[model samples]
Target: MKVTQRAKWRYQQVRQARRQIRYKFKPFKHTRVTRRALAAMVQRVVDQSQRYTLRAHKTRQDEYKIVINGWPDAVQVTVGVHSLSFLVMQHADFCDFLLWPDCMPRRKHGQWRCFDTGCLASGPYHRLEDLLFNHLAEPFLEFLTKVPEQAQLMLYDMEGMHHACVEAVKPLKRLDRPEHPVVCWPLPAGSDIV
Candidate 1:
């Protein structure tokens, strides 16, 4: 077989092996101490963020912006209410599921409120995961991967969300209008998750 084909086969074999290992030791890594420790670290890291002004005025999406870490260039991305914590949960896919305690959304009288921390009281949220995987995450990843060089995605979702953790960066355009970030949060009508 060709070298490229052989490499592909090897990659598949490695992926399968990893999946099996994860399935076997799935019960581990779930502990209160571990969760608190992780959260504390992430909170400290986020506190170090250099405040960047809100670019040209836009809606809440663009109005609230915090640039993600690890970009050599000054390409700014909108930091949705809980983007950091959300990214953390996404990255912790190594485990069965991420226990994000403070990522609850509160909707009161038809308004979606952003919760940075604390137990939220919201109801009738038919599309909870949809909002993240579809509205926020897809566009965020799209913008993150367009850079010339690979950048690191720091996630900050521990017990109470006190520390930021660096996550993976893959090349996949999940957004359409990279030039227009204000409209990127919602992504397109048929936005998808890879």
Candidate 2:
């Protein structure tokens, strides 16, 4: 093959690889294992009572599962307090947690778009910031303050991850919902959580 032709082919291959890479739904903050573990924990909390879905890194770096129990298959879960509690941990996993799309958003230009951004950021499942920064800190705390005491939450690493989770959920405690103390098992440091 000609050298120029070979270069062109290589370029195409690289682009294709990137496209494929971006399609995968791996949340940046928590490892794949972390997502899986959380899913299992949530399942245990609610059990398989309702016909629900669990999509780890459903689109990107935000792990979320919409669990709905008690229903007529029609009028059930509301997108407010339940979701607020449900995503308490998930919101902490990534900088931006998108509740919309079934997939995570890929990068556009230089930044990621996210569901929480109100279209300020683009997202099917995009990010507001990199996983680390968001994991370390984010703007979700205010929402956490509004939660009720009976809300059911599952924490994997409370002490270690508490800095992020607590801060993120703090604001939600003030939201209109009951708080449900959780059974937390902090992940061992450096373990391959995913």
The candidate that wins on lDDT is: 1
Residue-level lDDT of model 2, residues 111-157, one tens digit each, is: 44343343343332233333211321122222223323333333333
Of candidate 2, the 10-residue stretch with the lowest lDDT total is 73-82
User: What is the lDDT for 16 in model 2?
Assistant: 94
The estimated TM-scores of all candidates read 0.21, 0.20
Assess each prediction's global lDDT (C-alpha) against the native: 0.35, 0.33
Scored by Cα lDDT, where does model 2 land? 0.33
**Tens-digit per-residue lDDT, 133-178, candidate 1:** 3333444444433422222433332333333322344323432234
Candidate 2, residue 129: how far the Cα is off, in Å:
3.8
Model 2 misses residue 109 by how many Å? 2.9
